[model samples]
Target: MSFADQADRTLEILALTPGWHRLRDLRPDCDDETVAAIVLEAANFAEGVLAPLNPVGDRLGARVVEGRVKTPQGFADAFRQYAEAGWLGMDVPEKFGGQAVPLTLHAACAPLFERGCVALMMAAGSTRAAAHLLAEVADQDTANEWVPKLATGEWAATICISEPEAGSDVGRLRTRAEQRDGEWVVTGQKIWISFGDHDMTSRIGHCLLARTNDQPGTRGISLFLVPNEIDGRSNGVSVDRIEEKMGLHGSPTCAMRFDGARGILLGKEGRGLPHLFTMIELMRLLTGCQGLGLASAAADVAEDYARERRQGGRPDQPPVPISSHPDVARQLHELRSTTEILRAAILELATTMDIARLEPQSGLDDFTGWMLPLIKNFGAETGFNVAGAAIQVLGGVGYTRDWPLEQYLRDARIMTIYEGTTGMQALDFLTRRLWRDEGRGLAIFLQKARDEIDAYATEHPGASEAALAALDEFERLSAGMISMRDDDPDGALYRADAYMRAAWSVVSVWMALRLSETNAVAGLAAQFAFHSARCA
Candidate 1:
């Protein structure tokens, strides 16, 4: 089946009505049919242009030739087509050459793009995040100049956060910027800068963080915008080398050097880390969307192959496809059901964000804030697991380079490690979301889950029991952690991964239960039952 068909059907099965209604309430001019048309167009472009280039990009990754980073074959052209098609500006504002569409609409189309080529999408993803941050926080004059170009894909942008010695520990970074003749001159070496030095665009804008004072940790850090070119001349920014990676090779992971580069200060001084977090949050959400797309793509490939590959049969009858086998069927069902649940959850999350933007004090803000880490960490792990299951369905052939399953597995592996690792996500969830607020966010989510379960129980008592039991387990697990606060202060944190899993299992099953009403026979009940049994 085509990606368009898959996306449409998934949206239908998941019943996007609540999210759509919320979005429409915010933007009255937005129409569902128009969004659907755009999604179909995106799917066609993904299959026709991006999908064909996936293997080509993987085979011939990005390279630095004579100080300039060059992307794989067809990358530049495909990106141009992607930009011209208005995808870059779809969710951006009309003031900046964007369509100003609701984010929920964009969320629906994300998987199709990632399904086509995840590597290629990374560059665009970073740029889109950069554009969003600029729009939100940059000085109006500076933003007006840069946002339009980024929105139209006429310029690309990158986030420079990691250094050789400082990956997750941004406070330890040694890069420095000094005020000289009314300009900030930056000098530093940054590693793991995705799309850091690509020739796909004439100019690249970098959102860099550097120290300006002697204050320790993140206090002295300030954000800077370093252009790839200045006044028709090369900026001090240069690509030292591109890292060879396990996957997503087409997107450059550059080691960059800044030697007295002219920097435009972004936001206020000494507040760089906080401002840059806007970009990080946006990137993490996009990364989650990427995971969803890849997992769905993996399932697509697996199901297609399984339905055709004959395995066993009676002597007089034709051999049945491997999909007829119980175990293989189970894997496919898990993959499909998990992907659909994640989709619904992500869209709901997006709707919350859309609402929060207009009404910051609204209770939805807390949910949006709390959902980011889970969406990113769980989404990434789900993609990885589903991709591996896809390989299992294909048996030996899936492990070989002859098929794309191996590539999918390799590409999906990095999602958990980058954009902040899963461990980091768990820490944030436990400490920031739960501990610091004293369970404010957790209480909200649990209350919402309870309400849903009560509504569901009225119709399907058996499924409702399973759902309530899962929620009960979550509460018990959380209570045990909370009880250890004084004597076993670090115990809850040490078991943060377990907590994350438990919470996700409950929330995901809740989402599945909601979706089951529309897709009652889609085996979601069985899926939730299995998960609830495990939670027990």
Candidate 2:
């Protein structure tokens, strides 16, 4: 299925969710036809405008000329068109110049755009997340001042957390902010900042974290909105240099310096890390969309190549399509199944997120928390792995610049590293979501899985068996890990990766059942079963 068709199916499923009525109450015009139209338009724009730029950006990249970072040709213009189309504010609140649509719709549209060009679409997530963050945390006046611009994409934003000394250890960041002469002055340097300096927008807002007091660790850190341009002049924020990355050259990964840059404090002092979680959570979710986009693209390319390329056959007969081979056919099936399952899982999480927002008492928030780490990590892995698999399917041509698979592979490499690494996600899942939260999320997920299995048991009895077994194994592993946490924290940590994989297997199974019910993708449940058995 095409991305648009997948998005349409995702919406249809989301509409069937329990609290979907609440979403309609929130947005009266959010009917199936309207939303699907929006998604279709977005998919068209992404394919026609954004996908073509993927290769251009990869080749030309963004460059610094005369101390200013200029994005590759057509980037600035494309961004302008993107902004004018109001995609930047698709999920932002209407009061802040956004459409205020359900996040489910946003999530549906995201993968389509990401599949078009992840490097360029990188600017969209942070900007939209920043708008939401400001709406939630910032004062009315501050939010009023910045959120609209971000929502409109007249300005772009970046989450500035990492520094030379801090990557995942955000508390180790040394950037300092102090009030002087009735204004906050930020002085420090941040590295590995995406789109830190870009020509796509005249102004770039750094949603920054800075040490504000003598308190230790994260307690001293505070969030600030530091703009690159203040009152149409420089704000003492300068780009030191842009990193030469292995991929995503289209998006600039910048090292930035702030020498007494004026900043406006966001939220409360000494609460930067917690407040930034608002943006971090959204970015993490979007990271999953990034992976889905790449995986979908790779799957499409490989499947197309397999159907057209003729190779092995009996010596007496003419050559047949490689897809006729059992081995290649198996690879294609696994790739499609995994990609589609991940898409369903990601979209389900997004729908749950919407429900959580509309009806917090539904207990779906914990479910979202439980699933975020899984989707974020696995989503990225699927993209990179699918791209590599596509390269293998295409033989030598895929490895060369002629095919987009190599570029997809290179661009996808960073997804696992950024937006919190896979290790960090696994630890978060094992430690906080499972252990500290007392397995509330796990309990919810288990119940949901049971309900799904029961609902489909009669029709898909054979399918339910594998999923049920996987579900049981996940519960056993999670319980054991939680039990071991106090006695051997290191042991628990060591098993975190295994625990995470088991959880993914469980969710994939559940999604496979859901997909099977739709009959949208044939044999996905069995494909998942085959893979689960292999892993077991």
Candidate 3:
């Protein structure tokens, strides 16, 4: 079925989900129509502007110069189009040269960029997110000065968190931030800094994660807004080199050296991690969107290929496309189904963020805190699988440059690795998020899912019955598993992903159903819901 037809069904399901209804009602302070216009505008811009570059960007990878990197030929122009169109700061507060689109709308914006190239998508988005962090935590003077220009895309930004010695182990990072008079002098190496030396912006801001020697473990690490150029001059910072990566060649990932760089700190002195989380979680959500975008692009490519690539077939056949092959069809189905689930999962997280944004009274902050890793881990993993499967659908040709499948695969691999690996996300989710506040936050999430399922059944009799039946089996299985592991907290902890899956299946399908019911907006979601069930 056409994606539009599928969107109709998907939007209907969205209408039924409380979260979506909440989105319709919240609709930001802006009029519903205007907010929606921005949302559609972004989706269209991404489709029209960025989407076209996916294959081209792959073929014309970024080129490294003597001291800098230049993005693919058309990349800078397209990025300028993207930024000048106000796509760069969709959710930024309007007070600061941004549209301040609500989180729900911002959530919708992500898939479009992801469907583009991650290198470009993240490059634009990371700056937007950085602008957000500065708004939230930076001193008013700093934020006022930076947020406006940053929102306008006059500047680019990167989060400098990793060192050669520390990737996930943030506590072990050796980047040092020492107080010098009224400012900070940051000295250390920041590895794997994306967009590290691109020429798109006159200046770059690095949100440096450094050890302040205040305490121990993760707490002592502080976040510093270290400008690559301080006071209109290079702040003793130099790009050591850009790494040769497997994919996402359109974006330059650099290793930077901070030579006692003068910088300003954001938030309280030692409370950096919590403040930095303002950006980290936001980036994780964006990364999840990145994964989704890559998956969507790959799937679209695969679908088109399947419909065209003939494998010993006649035109008269209904399923003559290579997509007709049982194995190929199965792979496509799995990929599509997983994509739908991940998308549903992402929308669900979006809903949570919307709630957290619109109704801060809901205490959904902790809920979102728990959900960050889920979106990051699940979305990244699915993108990897989908990209790989897209290549698989093309056989030997997929491995070559003749088709974009290989580039898709290569670009997607780093998604699961960068922005925190799946294992790290899962581990963080299990050890920290799940049990924090003595599981009170988690219980709320479980209850929310339960409520969503109940509401779904109430709205749609037959499907609700089926969904409830499935929920019953799942709950029973879950309870039995829990009972079996009553003495084994470790086992329960280990089973987190399984538990999350079963929980998500029930809620996710309901989310699809809820989205399916909405008829008032762009109908892609409705098409998505029906296709989800068909693909499932």
Candidate 4:
């Protein structure tokens, strides 16, 4: 935590603010107070133990021997420490010896681990995500038998969908699954399987997808839980190779080859595409934090550097810290402001998921169905920008291994590419979320923003002109979007991302507004709103 420059004000802003556990408050059905405590404690441990290891991990990288991957020197020890703390089961069901913590709290703290080292975060990430999807789709016996071990970290898990040719076009996946001896045999080559193999866990299950000859396109595929180890044998699976990655080196990405690996059917046959979509949803939400968490770390690092480092000199004048430099301050400010918004956005969506889980019929559930990817895409992309700014603030040193920015950059690069790439996200936002069913979801989100503006305007007539203009422009642009839907799809969707930006800004600021209503920070809320409005 060397500080060439740092921002006391920025730190004060982050530290003094109280984070609302919105889900617990809004939805009583999904109580997670205990879960929050567990998540925060683990987050603190991760920050203390794992964050310190990241620079070393990046320098050391994961070793690939033969076809097996070994994490950086200390990662094994740290992973043991992590599991010893019972961090793995936080999100799994209580029946499976998991905490079954509310999604919001888990979402809240998941970022801290990623911030420590995103590569390593990806290791268990897909497991939990895929496992949760299994809980949704698999039979009770399957969940009972596998979830406990998976949650306890006795087994690792992964999602297998992408191949050499089938990425964004999930429908094009050519992996084949055929029934044999009352079980399915899977044969496919999957790339980018994070933590595809590790010596730390004995059992590895892959939530795999392949063609089943029932239907063509995505419907032809079904999800199967393929165990990598059975009776100490290969289980018809092989690690073809590990990816030589740019960052998150502590976590190895593998290309896996399945030679008729025996797997249990997950969920229903031919429902794999939709069932697997749930896993994608979960991963997208979690991966949203990946980029944001890493960017937040970069911001924290830059802020610390700025506050303490004295660069420019004056003969008679006292040396000013780098934070005193206007450009540095601006970078820190942008990073903090946008990060604040990003955190707010993610938290909002997290709470939405929690509420959905609690009250299945609550509008939040349907809203989350569409909004999850939107928030994920928004958070990560902004996070990339924030991490880049943090790097710029660090200058040449940022590009070197001597500092964390290069690792941050390498980590950020994958965020835009993985889970779902930025392009897919944009397409999802415009076509699936925004215009789907004539844009009901987007309209709901917009109404929420409008309600905030209306409430704030009524309560505080002195609301800044900036806020008002931003609100007005938001309304205008939204109208433009609606008007163009019938006449110009491209023009309309071109601004879909812009609309997303505006919506994120307004909603984030509104959160600060609504939150400050109880926190006695009306001025800060107004400032957040002003910054949000600047997106227009």
Backbone clashes for every candidate come to 0, 0, 39, 9
- For residue 225, give model 1's deviation from the true position in Å: 0.8
* lDDT of candidate 4 over 1-536, digit per residue (tens): 31111122222223322223445466454444444445557566767777888888777777667767777777767766766676767777877787777676677677777777676677668777766876778899988888877777777788887899998798898889998878889888999888888776788899888889857688787889999978888898888887888777777788999998999988888888788887888888987778767777888878887887788868688888989878777678767766665666676677667766766776655567667766777677766787789878887777777887777877778776887776677667667665664667666666655565566665554443345555666666666676777889888767666666666666656555544443333445566556555655
lDDT of 3 by residue, 366-478 (tens): 87777777788778877888888888887888788887767777877887677777667765665566544444456566677657656655556555555545555554645
- Clashing residue pairs for model 1: none
Model 3 misplaced stretches (Cα beyond 4 Å): 1-17, 28-36, 312-319, 323-328, 455-509, 512-536
Query: What lDDT does the true structure give each of the candidates?
Result: 0.83, 0.87, 0.72, 0.71
Summing lDDT over every window of 10 consecutive residues in candidate 3, give the lowest-scoring window: 519-528
Give candidate 2's TM-score. 0.96
Kindly indicate the candidate among 1 and 3 with the higher lDDT. Answer: 1
Worst 10 residues of 4 by lDDT: 2-11
TM-score between candidate 4 and the true structure = 0.88
Task: Say which candidate scores most in lDDT.
Answer: 2
| Candidate 4: count of backbone clashes, pairs at least 3 residues apart or interchain | 9
Q: What TM value does model 3 have?
A: 0.86
Give residue 361's error in model 1 in angstroms: 3.3
TM-scores for all candidates: the values are 0.96, 0.96, 0.86, 0.88
Of candidate 1, the 10-residue stretch with the lowest lDDT total is: 517-526
Order of candidate numbers by lDDT, starting with the best: 2, 1, 3, 4
> The CA-based lDDT of model 4 is what?
0.71
Regions more than 4 Å wrong, model 4? 1-22, 25-40, 313-315, 458-472, 482-486, 490-496, 511-536
